[model samples]
Target: MKIDLTQDMIDQGLTCPVGKRKIEYCDAKEVPGLYVLVTSSASANSSYYLRWKQHGKTKHTRIARVTDITLAEARSRALTLRREIATGNLTEEREQKRKQQMTYSDLFEEYVTYKRPFKRSIGKDIQFYNLRIKARFGSRLLSSISRHDLQKFQADLIKEELSEATADLYLRLLKHSMSLAEQWEYIEKSPGKGLKLFNPDNAVENHLSKEELKRLVDVLMSDENRPVCQIVLWLLSTGARLNEALKARWEHIDRNKRQWTIPATNAKSKRSRVVPLNDTAMGILEQLETEGQHETLWVNAKTGKRYTTIQKVWQRLRLKAGLPHFRLHDARHSFAAMVANDGTTSLYAIGTLLGHKSNVSTRRYAKYSSDTLQSISNHASDVIQDAMNGDT
Candidate 1:
């Protein structure tokens, strides 16, 4: 039977037929493909169903019970579902359920647990996530994070007075985490798939010039920020990264060999590297020993905690040194440049000293090698003189 669905019509209920009709259905006149199904005698409940012909096949789904929903609501819902049926968008409920699967925080905790076994920079990763990424995406669902969202985030990071390298590092971690989400089927695809790292050009290293280095030394001698300055001194002395120097433990130092061993957990390369210490580095260690006997190499006296970042210390020192743009990582470059220009050290020796795992990374200092520069200058002088003499 067919009728315009109404509260009064539904309230009256269906009349019984003479013979045993197993069931009865009435299609609503106001809305197409909407019907009420009544079971014969066996069941007292009735249900509203939405039916549609899709892709040459008949499909139907239960909307709601007649008792559970009002007649107006059933018709309104039926109208929406019918439009969606024509558009083949019937799986919106499944999409909503997918969005509730996992949050970025949940994924981050799981990713960290998976990575802590072998990732040397896991601590840095967690720190960056907490500082930069968590506020934006921590509670957001894995399935809901879109490429545009991450792109905007990447844009915001660069505008926040952070270096391009720092911003890129933040995105690099996100790219890997989201890639894992895609691989694990938590998300349909990684939103960071197309995100680009805005790697700064001519940014391989930013070593200090001799004049700037002298000024920095002057400020280091004058500054009262001893704890942070100590880390800066360690970095300048051994070319050790800030993290490697900050996390240095007393046990990792070989007093006899005058060598500092960076464990795989603290080493950025994920392998134990031995940094040979000079008198300058050894002297700093000796000075630190007089302060305390703790396993940690450097602790902030004010906080009594292991150092995380020397950014503020650097900001003050940079202004004082009049090298306002110099970054803490530049200390490593300055140390490498110092060694490279000594006229005796080879590129291979420079790489080993800095504990660089790759030769390509050490090659950036080729121009700084005095031997290489002097040899090139001699070649040019000989070529011009010889050519001038040859004509005579």
Candidate 2:
């Protein structure tokens, strides 16, 4: 009925709340707790009772009165109680009595410890963000964090010259940690609420054309370093991440099944994936078997240690080939493009082969594949001629 309760009504029975809804306190005959009175509309003939909750020596609040109450005012009172319970404000006084138990560092440490056995990159990424997070919000209790704190963290990363995509990754890590806190009931909402990540479309271009791929392969093959050449071929044939390929062990291969069983411990997605090794991929593996360094498939030529960084190797290869700044990881992009271009596999299968968790990540390969397909037949003669002349 939109009736506004006056001060006299509050002193008597009816009181207006924050938004000017009038409520009348009442004794519950049908329900277990105290009740409040409400009317459905301005012209409604009857009012109804809503159950009230009385906090012992703290404050009085309403919970529910009569389930069948149809008055608008009664429903509004019930709705308000529902919100209070949803946000866990029904017993704030009691909740505040417990001591604050954890800080951001404490929670982050828990997250790291829980994720330690899953993947090495998880450990590396946790350490990477740990320094930044501690520098900004170390002293603050986890309960005290808010969206503003996350905003400042993102701003600080931007100020440090981190590209938007990299900064967004750091922020997302924090968001994921905070989500764990939410699941533990440490907080009602994530501090990273309302945060928006920078669009990856603006940052790095990951795809490479077939010509670029041919040029890179040609340069690598002509170099005296045969290990890098084989590495390039395996990367292109398997579409694996650089780190994944570098850390591959002989123990993971099943020659009979023609599959490499990448363990969750070594995979970025924390899920083991079996990549089918094509004949070309198997040939590269066989070539590496002759190198006989360590049990690993790839190793450093100079130190004879398992290769870790492809930075210098990639730089020399690209510079010698007259290619612009493109990463070795682009080989995976080339593989996905070729597979999709030839119509040998669907986009979803391409994504699965690449170890991507979603179809969205795989969709980017579709564009390059579509473009490659249009000229596949026309370019065959030139590709053959270039290979014959050793001018690829």
Q: After superposition, how far is residue 362 of candidate 2 from its true place, in Å?
A: 0.7
* Model 2: per-residue Cα lDDT at residue 51: 39
Among the numbered candidates, top lDDT falls to 1
Alpha carbon lDDT at 46, candidate 1: 61
Choose the strongest candidate by TM-score.
2
Would you estimate the TM-scores of all the predictions? 0.51, 0.61
Compose the digit string of candidate 1's lDDT tens values, residues 179-224: 8676445677899997888878656567888888889888886788
Q: After superposition, how far is residue 29 of candidate 1 from its true place, in Å?
A: 70
In the range 188-305, model 2's lDDT, one tens digit per residue, is: 7888877898866863556567677778778876887778778878888999988898889888989899999888877888689999999989888777753445788887868877
Q: What are the lDDT scores of the predictions, listed in order?
A: 0.80, 0.69
Q: Which stretches of candidate 2 lie over 4 Å from their true place?
A: 1-102, 119-132, 152-162, 289-294, 299-304, 371-392
lDDT of 1 at 375: 87
C-alpha lDDT of candidate 2 relative to the true structure: 0.69
lDDT of 2 at 1: 28
